[model samples]
Target chain A: MQMTWREIVTAVHGMLFGGFFLMACFGVLVLLHRSLAAHGGSEVKEHGRRRERIFLILMVLLGWAAVLSGAYVVYPWYRAAVPPGVTNLEMYPQRLLMSDPHTAGWHTLGMEWKEHVAWMAPMLMTMVAWVMMKYEDGSEEHRRLRAMVGGFALAAFLAGGVAAEFGAWINKKAPVTGGRVITLSQDGK
Target chain B: MSSPREAVANGAAGAAVLAASLGCFALGVLAVAGDGWKAVAGLLTFYRPTGPLSGVSTVAILVWLATWFTGNRLWRGKTVALGKVSVAAFVLLALGLLLTFPPFEDLLLGK
Candidate 1:
């Protein structure tokens, strides 16, 4: 089955956002586990440790996938679509957004938000991963590190949330269009 | 059973590493101010320079530190190895950021 560019981009966006949500969920789970392990039943402590280890690993992997996939799609599309003469992104949002130039303003803003926020995910996720690796659960040192890492994870998740929302908003508000063919001559090529 | 001094030192190092990673993220955002979509896209990658290099470095260094702390014999000499790699990667990331700015791009690439 040959999917249109719109279909393909949408599918990719779905995968991208799905990764973000999963990362957020797991990040929160790991953080909650750490909290519960501090002053809870032994069973819950065991459960938190297990969940922290497993979910942290998953969150790290998904964060990497989202970062790479986002870069792979956004970069090439930007280069190919925008012509040389265009000065600003706002000037030619149609090319970047795959929409009519007339109404590409909001979509352009959304893309900007998506790009900036998406960049925050990797650093935060990796830091949390590093903390998990560095410290044993339930120790004095581990608790300190976990608190810091948990904060980073929360921030990363928020950024991912914004990026995903802006991405969805852009896709829906300005659904991708079948690109136009330009000709040099006065008439059809 | 680490002494308080050792714990304090480790915490300091971890905080520094986290700061460097955050610096890289800030660079990504700042680079976008000068260039446009290309800069934005470049800064979003896991590769060297204007993007995730510091984050990558933090991860590598942290992993080595963690393994060392945990008495993992296999990662011996990783400290020196990672330090060298990080120096090179930071240089590249700096260069990448410089090039992303249009003025620098014009100077280096030549319009």
Candidate 2:
């Protein structure tokens, strides 16, 4: 089996970074909900607090990694221009999708929306992480802070979901292909 | 009694949330601007390969950092009214989210 370099990068961006970011979003949601009891107060211990900070920091890092890889690494390949007389647009995802009317919406709606929306995830998550780091108590004041940041976390999750969904659908419609190929395994003759 | 350092304050959290929302809103506004205006699009092309996206994201991030630093500096250790801050932040965030939507953007630009 063989896979192109771009394919691997895209896979890493999607399956690894994007996938883990989504899971982390969900985990933070649950963690925050439990941390701030509805009646008021938190049950998180000191160790748990440290662990939470680590996770949130990691989540923020993952969010940035996902968007940066997608925009800088994979997106350049996706939006690469097609040379004249090159009828095969296989290497150009944006052009490929736009070539057909039926698939045009994939680029216009899917990619346009995904590229911009994905960014909200990291910005909001950064805020959520910093705020979580600050409010380290179980008082009513801290609980309200947790609840507000929890809402921000929920928004971050939705943005990530939208981006991942569109990224998957767009790639399926016109995948980014080309670049040096690597053989996964050699055949025994 | 809890010491000053030990007191629970909403200033930092408020600052962060507000700054993040402003950054997001800046991104949404720039996205729409870049899409609607050719001059804006060309101006925002910091990286030729990445088009306006690189500039858009970079500027928004800078705006976020600036606002966060300023807000933190001014609001740190002060217990500002969080309810008002939360309302403004969420509203800005909602508008930002709306502006980034393709259909909504089109509606604004008459595209």
Candidate 3:
């Protein structure tokens, strides 16, 4: 089977995006390790290590999400281009695609949003964790505020990503003309 | 028994390595953009992945590995500076990745 330009473009985009996201995830893991080492000592007396672990886990999970989304964006194009009978048809319908340019653009935007949030979430949590360590004598209100901010940021980032992915999926599945061709020629030329 | 001062120096060195890695990653991104699949294929598998951003990811992985090594060394030494630098590098790496996304790239290039 021949590869369409669209499929080729999408595949290239997906691979680059996926590779970057994977790097980001790896970076997050590095950061998580550093944060835990640096500030794991200062968490609340009863919940210190647990809190740090939770944040670390969250960072790691965010990395996985980015990687997964990146894969979703690219794998469809690969499958589409694969020769029939060489690959399973069951996989093709399950592949992700944005039916229109607008949807594709939005989904691309969504991936960016997800990546930014995933990056920020760990940094923010690391800051909060550091602060908790420094202000061991600080009030509960301050700690609560830090947690609230970090949690909110994470939620917002995740929501934006989910929305983008959903939008892309819906757009791809939207009913539309499957095949139509148009050509223009100068009169009597 | 490495002194605290020595640890700090080592941490700084590690941070520098990570910074360099990030720069390389950025360069790879740009190369992918300018040259497309050929650039990516050169960086990733030998099979020659096609398109502008094709194998640009392979270069990214290398950079990430370098950063991880530096950060890991610094963490082992318990240097707060190294930890901070690692976090900063990670943030930059993430930002760079986001910037390479098609939407952002289009906006930058007015595509």
User: Which number leads on TM-score?
Assistant: 2
The TM-score, computed over Cα atoms with residue i paired to residue i, of candidate 2 is 0.95
Report backbone clashes per prediction: 1, 0, 5
Better of 2 and 3 by DockQ: 2
TM-score (0 to 1) of chain B for each candidate: 0.30, 0.92, 0.49
| lDDT of each residue in A1-189, candidate 1, tens digit only | 244564465456545544555556565656546564665334235666687677667766766666555555533343244567775554233364545665555444555445545655555566566656556445554465455556556656666676677666665654443333333355443
* Each prediction's TM-score versus the true structure: 0.56, 0.95, 0.43
**Tens digit of per-residue lDDT, candidate 2, span B1-111:** 123432466687889999999999999999999999999999999999999999899999999999999999988877777778888999989999999999999999999
Please give, for residues A59-79, the per-residue lDDT of candidate 3 as tens digits.
445444544443344433332
For candidate 3, give the DockQ: 0.05
Candidate 1 local Cα displacement, residue B2, angstroms: 13
Supply candidate 3's per-residue lDDT for A112.
Answer: 34
Ranking by lDDT: 2, 1, 3
Q: Residue B75 deviation, candidate 2, in Å?
A: 0.7
What is the lDDT, from 0 to 100, of the residue A67 in candidate 2? Answer: 97
lDDT of 3: 0.41
Q: Identify the leading candidate in terms of DockQ.
A: 2
Per-candidate Cα lDDT values, in order, are: 0.49, 0.90, 0.41
